[model samples]
Target: MKTKIIYLLMACIFLVSCQNLNRPSGQMTRVERVVSGQTIEIADRSVAVPLLEPIRLIGIQAPDIRQNPWGQEARIQLEKLTLGQEVLLEFDTQEKDGFDRLLAYVWLGGKLINEYMVKEGLALAKPDFPNTKYMERLTNAQEKARLMGLGIWNPNQPMRQTPGEFRSQNLKQ
Candidate 1:
């Protein structure tokens, strides 16, 4: 009876841990370029053979070229994260978005780049998926960076507005 109880408890723990929803066995590949703050084109398209696919780094949104003052900063940081670099790209089970960008987590030197963006306050942890792991940690990092006013959080920086929004707002009457 004692042995059975111990086994049951261990099984329960394993079950709980296994529920983490990230894509298992997602392949690693070499980054070809920093197409955007959250995306990189990869070289090893094993499923499609040399057809470079755009992998969107999961969990964070770097400043966009539009209306986010940190546009340059985001691009710069992302470049630093994976410019012609080799990194592990982990996928979400939901896979590609409607726009066809492959959703993934970019890991470099055992570090998660998506979470790093939030940690460094260069991005926000936009939660579209449930986290079997790392959500709280990501949020805490983003909060700390946000509080410190780093990068995009800097108040004196120029804000980002889209071309449409810019024209509407600043265009002369």
Candidate 2:
């Protein structure tokens, strides 16, 4: 009887652990739109993708509303890049951030959106979480942009505090 109970307990633990790992894997989906700078829609047959649940372009950091300069332009460019395009999403360890969005690599045609933004000097390479495939590219892009003083790199650019910094400030409270 004790052996049976132990087995049952083990089974229960296994089932619970499996549940968290059951989120969606890498799935190719056409991007319906760029909801915001860090969010996107991956159309699925089960249902239309939720706007609130966005797939972040992992391993890259775009300006958030509270982040560095040119956030508006970053969002605008994201909108332009992803609207009505068929995008491929690659998922890593995190399914999403705290907002329940899907953390994913958004690829349009053959270009990796995360790397492109940084290379254009429109964003910075941030090692946000699990996805780091394009780290080198993102770094190089930011360096080139900074050297050129293009886009947000310009002296007059309005820079916003990063999410990390914001979180840290709040944490001290």
Quantify all predictions' global Cα lDDT against the true fold. Answer: 0.71, 0.70
Candidate 2 per-residue lDDT, tens place, 1-173, comes to 99999999999999999997743335777777676566676654675754334677777666665454466678778889988777777776667687777778777776778877777656677886465666677788778887887766776763445645655776698
Instruction: Write out the backbone clash pairs for model 1.
Output: 67-160, 67-161, 68-160
lDDT of 1 by residue, 49-139 (tens): 6777788777676656444556667777889878888788676566787679888877888788888887776777776474224567677
Please give the TM-score that candidate 2 achieves against the real structure: 0.69
Cα distance off (Å), candidate 1, residue 113: 0.3
Question: Which parts of model 2 have CA positions greater than 4 angstroms off?
Answer: 1-25, 48-52, 66-69, 158-160, 166-173
Off by over 4 Å in 1: 1-25, 47-49, 130-133, 158-173
Cα lDDT for residue 159, model 1? 39
